[model samples]
Target: MAELARIQPSLWFDSDAREAMEYYVSVFPNSHIGSITEYPADSDEKHLSGMAGKILNGQFTLNGVDFVCIDGGPYFTFTEAISFVVLAKDQAELDDYWAKLSHVPEAEQCGWCKDRFGLSWQIIPENMGDLTRTPEQLQVVLGQKKIVIAELEAAGAGI
Candidate 1:
């Protein structure tokens, strides 16, 4: 068995854990679906009655980070309070991630976007701090959905 990550972020899905896992692996490089444990068809527990064949625990890797997800019914959901950060090395990388992940237009703000799976992601440049050194640059960033590094640079240069 492969060694697991010391701390993996687990996602709770209503009934699309498998689909979400597959979608995520497709979005990021160096990603793949791992072990998947399904709920028993004959489960007697009331909470798991209709969960036959549903994912109990689905492990996956995305961009070298380990994560787990489950088809845990509609008792819980994803919130913007907890978001994953994708620090891109450059504008092209950032644009690619934003293009692929930004599905909920209403949820986008300040380089943060919500994916189709309802998960929030902050896709920003790795040197965001440096780019937004000035208040003007910071304001420019806050006004855009996607992080345009060149715009920030222009703002910082008083262009």
Candidate 2:
């Protein structure tokens, strides 16, 4: 076994950790599912009765970033406070991710969107800083649900 990542984001799910992990791996390149530990069937804990056979801990990599997830009962959920940022190389990549991940239209704002599983993601260009260097360019980005690299560049250049 390889050494564990220094910092891995752990996600808690009601009972869909495996599904979520698989979906993520399919969406990203260089990604794969790792070891999955299921809850013991003979556990004495009544509280975990429904969790038997479910994923107690599942590891996966999304574009090389390590993440762990569990099928723990729904005591919590994802929120906008914490979101994954995808620095896309260009508009095509950004649009591809946005098309696949953006499920909640109400949550869309400034390149941030919520996936079907309620996970928030910021799909922005790799050169976002350079594109939004000017106030007009920043405003252009802020007003758009998905970031348009060309628009930002035009705004930055006063076009």
For each candidate, give its TM-score against the true structure.
0.93, 0.93
lDDT of every model, 2 decimals: 0.94, 0.91
Q: What is the lDDT of residue 85 in candidate 2?
A: 98
Question: Which RMSD values do the candidates have, in order?
Answer: 3.2, 3.0
- Highest lDDT scorer: 1
Clashing pairs in 2: none
Error of 1 at 36 (Å): 0.3
Query: Could you tell me how far off, in angstroms, the CA of residue 156 lies in candidate 1 after the best superposition?
Result: 0.7
For model 1, how does the per-residue alpha-carbon lDDT over 110-131 read when each residue is reduced to its tens digit? Answer: 9999999899999999998889
